[model samples]
Target chain A: MSQDLVFGLYIFALATFVGYQVISRVPPLLHTPLMSGTNAISGISLVASLVVAGEHHDRFAAVLGFIAVTAASINVVGGFMITDRMLRMFNKKKAPALAKAGS
Target chain B: MRESLINLAYLVASVLFILCLRGLSSPEQGRRGILLGELGMLIAVVATLFKAEIVSFEWIIAGAILGSLIGTAISLKIPMTQMPERIALSHAFGGLATSLVGIAEFHRMRDMADAAATVVAVAASEHALNRLTMGSLGFEVFLGSLTFTGSLMAFGKLQGFITGAPVTWKGQNVMNFAAFAGVIGLLVYQVIFLTAAPQWMFFTMCAVGFSLGVLAVLPIGGADMPVVISLLNSYAGLAACATGFALRSNILIISGALDGSSGLLLSILMSKAMNRSFANVLFGAFGTGGGAAAALPVGQAAKGYNEATVEDAAAVLTASQSVIVVPGYGMAVSQAQHAVRDLATALEKRGTEVKYAIHPVAGRMPGHMNVLLAEANISYDALFDLEMINDDFARTDAVIVVGANDVVNPGAKTDAASPIFGMPVFNVEQARSVIVLKRSMNTGFSGVDNELFYMPNTMMVLGDAKKTLISLFGAVKGDGH
Candidate 1:
């Protein structure tokens, strides 16, 4: 009923459509990397976690917030790093092949 | 001004994330796309640190540093063959963080409301935590808690720490349904009927969520893991989206939607590849009694198959001018990817053109085979999907099936009564000669007997796939000498 909630719902619906359009085009070759990449991006929850950990509202909340921050940062850091490592392997055979195909 | 800057940063980050996914459509732009995502994450984190509400920095700094160290170690040390397990574990972490944030938010809001009631009118208590926020928080905790345990179960199965067979018992589906209903009932009660938040109800929902996760995934066989992993990825994303509603952060909502849709699409694709609907995979207990019962039929039919040695297989390869290799989860189980690549190289040296035919649902997750092959230093250009290379099988002189069975079975196309009858499979039978490298005559995870193994032109080389491939490679290389 609130204006902000209404706007959030709108964003959620539209972003989902955008996501479908973008993800459907991704080939099966990079699917593993795509999953990990989106996973790392979803760690955007780290933004919320930082506020909870740093707000100093209460000791109990802060402790929970600390763990939340740590867990989310792992996804952010590990997911992206592993994805990059996988993509690097793919690039090895792609560079020359893609060059010839493009020309 | 400060709020505007943070919102602007989130908007920019959303665009970057979208572009990053677009970049993933090809192998050439994949790494650069990941770099864009990393930059977006950095920008979002920096802007959050400048928020006006945050009063302290020590805990945030400490958690981030420790997490980065552990994450880095894991990324650097894990082998590509273990990618499915690693991705499942990462989903668990994502779920854990989302649920913990929801719990903290709920606790803070209750305390703030209590504190406000003493200074202002009694009605002012509701202002701190409204009905909408309560609903989204409940939604967040439910999905986040379930995804946490579900992913861990998937990880355990993939890592071989737990049995990969479908574990079922009497009335398993009924019990799962009850637990799922309980969570929804609790969520509906607290969010809609009560003015005050009850701690017991919320935590009870959390417990039920965890139980539902374990029960739901318990009956799914190892072969159905690609769908399970993708579905969990979707749950983790939806949890984050609900968290965004609780916190009113647009970036969280946008990224969560992207992640959620990506998982949903992949699950659909994976399910289609196996010719099974989502409901069948979730509740059919697909390979439960079928595996043991199916083994008996295979035992009777085994007498008709032709078993060959490495020398015969090497001779077959030597005569062929073109070869296609089909890989499956068996390859991953035996860790034979490097050996596969070596054999292909030897075949290539003798003027045999070798290419890989990758099924969409091969291995434990989507794109599982591609990553393993890439790690083995095989050119991505040599790998073809079912659509690209299915027709080429007829023209090829030989087809080598390494640790793969069901994907190439002719039963999928010819037998209507077969469980996997509608699934698309490679036409290995159409090739001039077929060489199958398997450890034993055991049926695949689906528990179906493969007719391809009994075909006259098909030669079954029984042994450890890696050892067989190594021997075959040696024979081919020796011919050159």
Candidate 2:
């Protein structure tokens, strides 16, 4: 493989390992929030989409990039907001602190 | 300098996202986790605007504003019960976006190839329909197109727009596999031939991929929705990763890998928790009672069970010193968590300790029951997982199984011939006195009859969970100490 391909694969492999380690420890009750949180993280693509749409000044590329930016933005904003809402409810309970104490 | 700045900012954003996952897994740290995730997204979005080529911002700004407004409205208005469907819809959008960009990029590159045909370096270069890029595009479009339809199918099933049961027909699996294989076949052909292949071939692959997505999910019963959701989640991440490859974007690659791997892990963990294989979950055509082992003779259904009145169930509850409530999808369907909570409160006032027994696959999604209970303001301490609280069932005075069937079904443990056999289930039958609140003697999604219902210690309170629990609440409170 070429140098750039090797670099990309290395990043991909290491990221997967890190992700697996991080998520394995999560409590089941946090599954929903974890999902939504990651949903927001996936929205990171909105940035590249914005650059692709604006950087080239090409008509069609701009259109595709705009739509991608829109979709990713929705995922980011709605995902994080809903997660925040759910996490708020979870935090409202004194039970979280107490439950973890026993574990 | 500019490229390095962008890369550095992306690195920072990646770190924040990592922290988000780390903190999000714990209930107590959930809020900070979301905050970090949001901050990371903000930094990444802002940094992207500084890329040297972006001369115009009108369309970008417009799209963001419109998307944000719609997204905010959805987040604000969607009921928490519908969150899973909402998530499925989000997956659909993300998948669509990625595929659209991939197609656009390929078409643009093809146009360049045509324009530069006379330039020997351009025409003869590996990039004359670059094999690496085409391979990634093939991977990206195949997954993205399928994930788009699969998630929409899931949303339809969850939202009541489609038949909630497993939709299986003759040779559905064979057909699904064929469709998927066709997409892969075309994708491979496209990779080998690059732009030499006709453009219609790629779009045709997308068409078949879409159909494959729908058929793949149709055979899956609604009961296994948690697995399906997480599996689709993994698919969405893989699609994103493939797009990252096609685009050569660092943030997309890192975050997509993170999302993809975590989703797969969650799916595997859920499958393990339920004591089923991923293959079993995918092709088992599970949750349809029509499976081979569940051939209950017509009119023989009521022979093994007896129903009890609300007072008899209440008397058992009133006499109990400790009660463990095991909830399932029926509670969510009937919206009985609040009534159940009221019943628990009344039971507690009567000097009984009440805790919930949450089987990992209790509802349509993992942690679905927790979300319902939390929405009703039930204390988190009152909820206990199967592992943490399964042993407590034997010593408890009573288990008020609220509309839960499969999770509490003893068949998972006892009947080797049963569809749910070998699947982990709550040992509700082991409790001293089992008080079951269900509408009737219906089998759960696994298509197996619950032997727990027939056990002598079990008392079936046949009615709607909310109505029954509400009455039980009244009956227990009306009986003076």
Candidate 3:
């Protein structure tokens, strides 16, 4: 019922709206790059959640914070693993005969 | 409620997550990034479990156990070849869960208000109206719904349940434009209607969201999977962000925003790699194989380059000091990257210097060959890009063309009448000798006979890529005779 709470909620709503609009217009071709790039941002969220939870001495707040941290962490970990795997595919060695046979 | 502990935990977790993401940007440190992310999650989960009011511990436990089991099963069963599809499917699940959570929360609030009014016997419905006033819930519902459906469609396409080509009519762009307009119109209408009476508008919006997801992915082809995958990733992130807003969670918003932006950047890089615009990739009819001009007959080419057996190829390779391997879409189709890797290892043991020459557009997708090679666990330093290895061909004792055609075809650069005239190709002919391994003298995806096949220095090794590579590997290792 507080004015500050209402203002905070409104700001979040605005962010959601703006974020949705921008994301929807994104060309499908830019998906991977965008995903990889935003992956870092997701990291920021994890940090924010952690900080919030640590500050809240209340048991409920702490628990919620932990959950957020866990989920975000999963996203970050899996994302990097997959990205690294993808990049390595680009530099695979060829059979040696290819060099010898061509000569 | 003490806030200091919560803030501190949030800060540490966020810092770790950021560091993890930054590490993932490069191929070398990507694994570290994953570990950091895992650490962040562990911290978040432990922190959240400390909450006091969460009475449904049983449900959370059950959900966590089930989820972990499923995740483990998927990771163990799915091959690296199907990793992209798995990621897409995961995105869909994430979006769906977020949407369901928003719906549940919204309904709970509505029911609570209704119950309070009934118990008090109040004539005013103002409390119930106020409960439904949160715009964050609606936004979450919309974005989550869209991401869920869109990601599913993408998964289906990648899995080959749907055609990979751009599904469009003559005026498809106009239709897409109109559909988008209609979605916006309905969204506005729903918002206005929600202010008064909750009608079928909510369901209608969900339907529109689902349709938008389908429409967004329907135009992309199999060849442009990297871009599509990245875009879907962004949708999932944005959906998460929406969920955060609905829940008034700052962590969610920040993480979601990060995911959304990275997905955008990845798509851009992938598009640039293909030398195409994002718009062109989206609207263009891709994966139309066999549309190129018919290839010239094998017999019509210069007589010296007629097909030879694997034994002959082995002889030349064994006698040669240096070999250059050129791979193409055929190698990918036959899944012969491992065989090629094996053959390379064998040759290297024989004191033969082997180097792989990769063309920019060798396989169906960008980095297709690289992915295959990586799966074979070949060393990174051994693979050479076209520019890096082209000049060295002249000194090569033999050039082994494995399932490669268009990329190494001399006609692409020298022959004016060639359909792929301007496309850059490997200068394989510059090598002192050339050996091509193929099932037949068929042309490539571009549908043109490779003139390099008939060049004086070239000899065709006719057979399946996998079988031929295996035989060649055996032959090279058999006494080096």
Q: In DockQ terms, which candidate is top?
A: 1
Worst 10 residues of 2 chain B by lDDT: B291-300
Off by over 4 Å in 2: A55-60, A91-103, B118-125, B289-294, B297-299
Ranking by TM-score: 1, 2, 3
C-alpha RMSD values across all candidates:
2.6, 3.1, 7.7
lDDT of 3 by residue, B22-53 (tens): 55444465456556656765676566656553
The reply for model 3, stretches above 4 Å from the true place, is A1-103, B1-4, B25-29, B51-53, B105-143, B190-194, B197-199, B289-308, B319-321, B324-333, B357-371, B384-463, B479-481
Each model's C-alpha lDDT? 0.89, 0.80, 0.62
Q: Summarize candidate 2's per-residue lDDT along B304-394 as a digit string, tens digits.
A: 6758999998988999888999998889889898898788777766667778888888878778888888877787777888889988878
The alpha-carbon lDDT assigned to residue B352 of candidate 3 equals 80
lDDT of 1 at A58: 91
Point out where model 1 deviates above 4 Å.
A92-103, B194-197, B291-302
Highest lDDT model number? 1
Writing each residue's lDDT as its tens digit, candidate 1 over A20-57 gives: 99999999999999899999999989999999999999
Q: Could you give candidate 1's per-residue lDDT for residues B173-219 as a string of tens digits?
A: 98888888888888788777434647799888888888787888888
Least accurate stretch of 10 residues (summed lDDT) in model 1 chain B? B288-297
TM match of model 3 to true structure: 0.72
